[model samples]
Target chain A: MAREKRRWVAYGLTVPSYLWLAVTVFLPLIVMLYFSFLSKMPFGTAEPVLTLKHYKSFLDRDFYHFLTWRSVKLGFHVTFFCLIIGFPAAYILARKVHGRWREAILLLIVLPFWSNTLIRIFAWTMVLRTNGLVDQMVHAIIPGAPSVGILYSYPAIVIGLVHSFIPYMILTCYISLQAIEDSMIEAGRVLGASSLSIFWRIILPLSLPGVVVGVVLIFVPVVGAFMEPRILGGRQSIMLGTVIEDQFTEVFNWPLGAALSFILLAIVMAIFAACYPLLRNRMKLT
Target chain B: MTRWIAYGRRIVGMMAGLAMLGATSVAVADEVRVLNWKGWGTDEAWAVAEFEKQTGTKVVHDYITSFPETFTKLRTNPGYYDIVVLNAAFVEKAAREGLIQAVDPAMVANSADLYPDMRDTPQLNFDGKVWGIAWVWGGTSVTYDTEVFKTPPTSLDVLWDPAHADRVCWRDNAEDSVRFAALALGQNPDQPEDLDAIREKLRALKPQVKAFWKSGDEWLKLVAAKECDLSIVWTNNTEAAAVQDNLPVSFIVAKQGAVAFRDGLAMPTNPPNAKGAYAFMNYLISKEFYAGWVKIGGAPVSANSKAVEELPDSSLTRQVLTQPDAIKRLNFKGPLSDEERQTYLDLWQETKAYFAE
Candidate 1:
């Protein structure tokens, strides 16, 4: 009887949060799914007919296919770069750094999260544009160096996204890496294991959970990013997110946009599903 | 635990009461909410202050970056905004869809001072009723770096010139891009008889484009940074770049003619504050307001004839405003049929895809 009362209390505490999610996230998604199946907007004089035409649009257009592939490729490139850059930084913060300086360094690593992301992206344009800071610096060193304007290019897009998302990776990895006891490394070293072996066998396996979590967190949002690419990549940017944005904003085709959103969500879910076994193993180890 | 729960319940009750009080206060307030593009509202802050002082109605400006956002916001929150400033081309659609109402001429005291061409334009009227009052107008023209070109580019064909390959920027808008391409090909941009030819022309110009800018700020940055030598941009952006940023750029109408657009104020259907809306609209077009608007807003011209005459002839704003020849050469793009719009969208998609490759 007492346990039943305690369970009810826990459920009551969670009910408000679950209810909020239902209204904000789940309800809109269900409505979007309904809209995706409709031929035209139900608003105004248009008679709503249930149809697969919006889905058919995806299949019929090769450009949509290309954009989907491009978005996925962007997700991979950003995730790869983040992991390569973030893991070492996180490891050093977790293992090497000590005392109050560790706290200061970690604070610095996650500081970008405290500021506005759009403003940060805009700042990059100032640094990367022709006659911008980078160009001026390069000219100062090499006097009459060729233009180093990298703004409005694909590289700029990747650089901006990586800068924005790297903190997520570092934070996650730092948490997991900090949990690794110093005695474990000492034990491996005493067992005649080389430093490389110690990292490969002990540190890597232990931090895989954080790495997986970071990849999932960064990859999902980057795949749906439109603003960064639009601002930084310029004409070179043509991700599925931007196309989906066009449908709703410029084209005024909500049904098509809804369909495209579902396709992107499905792709993201499939990726998570494919990586579930590996993620599960890492979770177990942690 | 019981005491803590009681405290939490009391806190929640008090919060709900506070929220209700806030809601009631807002409901009792006499305010007019005007929706417009960012930086496109009343030119002077003092003007809004003056309007509030004259009438007890507080004027609120809700700024958006694009026209589509205006439609989305108005549609989702009906009766939430009293007045909306939009392009003239969208007035008919907005009225037909009941997003906005027919303007009552009696409400606008400055209607008589409006330029005849702008005031009597069919674009602002539909079914013998005015839907929007013409507010500010500007031209879309080629803006190029003076350092790059010794002489100003005379034609829209400069966008396709090989010498400026990978150094040109165009707007990423479907309507404007396709229209400009059609003009470049010497075809009627408004009523393109052959979309294929226009598509081919746009596809050919793809190699020359460095970027398709989405915002005026982006265009300014691209030109200011020397990242782009040429761009199809609004006259005001060029003006701001030259006058404000000290960017060496010149705004010139191409020989083939540039696109001119007029934005106007209209009341939404069943506005919550009709009187406040009318008051704000009148103040927006008043003669006293135009001088500050021309100076601060960087608007090329005012639809009010009296406002145009008031400006000094030597001023850049006055020069841009009083150019009857430039106005005559401008091909004012109007609303497209749904079918034509779809075709353009499809062509634009194809062009973007081609360029992406």
Candidate 2:
């Protein structure tokens, strides 16, 4: 009877979360799919008349395909950059740093995030402005070498996204890295493995799980990033998120926005599906 | 044991006495709920105090930085605010959507004293029915550091000048860039058909900009720090930062007029206290109150020319603050058909890409 009561209590706890997911997540996506086929009202609301016209617009041979390809490229760039930087940083935090110092370093990683995300992006803009800190530093380092302000460029957007999200990647990878057993490395060395060989054979394989999580966590959002690209990236940095934002804010085309959102979701899911098989194989091999 | 029980009884009595004292304390007064944009509606606290001193109405003001967020709150829970400051575009949109109630302008005697220009703006009214009272009139203008540019570059072409590379800031939105570029290229910013040209113009300018600012504070800091040479900004924002923060900046009346906008006061359609909300809107438009609010907020009021004349040295007001001529030149953008808007957005994105390239 006590076991039955505990089971009932467990069910009760799970129900609210399930209900919340249904209301906030599943319901919205379902509604979005429904709306994606509807005509946009003059005042920017959705109408009852369903049509495939919006999807047909998306099939524009020139424009739609180009944006989709560009978006995937930008998303890949962000993910790759984050992984290259974040992995080393996470390793240092998880395997190298001592107790209190590690805690202190972790605090520093999260300190900037305490500010509003928008404000933090703007801070980078201030640093990267033409006469701003970065430009001044560049001028000081190489006199008359043509000052380079990084703001509003593709590099700036990539750098800003990396800076803002690298901490998340590091923290995520750190958890997985910390779970790694020290004896495993010693065992690899005992089997006549050098530092590089041990890292390649043992460490890299073990960390694949973390790498997968980090890539998905960072890549999914970076694909749809709006503010970072819009702020740091000049007109050239129009990513997928900016497109979605424009549809809703300026165009008032909910159906089109919904359709775009679904496309983004499908793209993300495809990436996840493609990655899942590889991750599972790697997990088993490791 | 008997002595201990007696002592415990006395302690319990004292604790009960303290609890009773806490419960009996005078009920704290409820605050009047208000919602509006940050800089503009903050004076409501002072107004509330003044109102309380005179007519004993307790006012509590809450500010929201986002238009959609505020509208969402109003739509979902109309009782959340006694008053809301709305953009004229959203005012009409909301009223048409039945998200807000029709306000009877007769109740607001001060609104009758408004400038003829404001009352007649088609965006501010629907079928001769007023939805909101004018609060502040401002718009996007070209602003720069006087020290850097020396003389203000008059034309929008300056934004696209390759020599100005990495020294420009824009609105950080494709649609805004498209609109500005279309206008710059002598294409109609409002017309959807002009999007392709706008995109072409933007592509040309993308290389010049260093950043696109999304917030007023970000724009202010960028200009103040001399990060970028120029930014397209709202007049009040540049004015407040320059005059108040002493930022080295000036708003320029570009050769081609800029985007002009009006923000106004409106009662939510189903406000919990409609009478109080109307009274608040009425009080906001009184010439004396309007002038005072504008002075502190550094926002241009839509009051009559005579009311503006009453302020001393207001000539040195924010560059666009008093520029009716600038307003005349502006091609105000209104709500567009969804398809047309989508096409414009596509053009905007295309333009942004061209600029970046």
DockQ of each: 0.30, 0.18
Model 1 chain A lDDT-worst window of ten: A40-49
Give TM-score values for chain A, per-prediction. Answer: 0.94, 0.93
CAPRI verdict (incorrect, acceptable, medium, high) for model 1: acceptable
lDDT of candidate 1 at residue B290, scale 0 to 100: 77
Model 2 pairs whose backbones collide: A152-A234, A235-B352, A236-B356, B32-B60, B101-B269, B203-B354, B203-B355, B206-B355
Worst 10 residues of 2 chain B by lDDT: B1-10
Clashes of 1: 0
- Measured as a fraction from 0 to 1, the native contacts recovered by model 2 come to 0.39
| Candidate number of the best lDDT | 1
Tens-place lDDT per residue, model 1, B325-347, is 76667887687765565567767
* Candidate 1 ranges with C-alpha deviation above 4 Å: A277-286, B1-25, B315-322, B337-339
The Cα RMSD across the true interface for model 2 is 16.0
lDDT of 1 by residue, A1-286 (tens): 9999999999999999999999888966876787787775554444556789888888998988887888888999999999999999999999998999998998898788899999999899898887788989999999978989898788899999999999999999999999998899999999999999899889988988799889999999999999998888866776888888888877667788899999999999998899899768765763
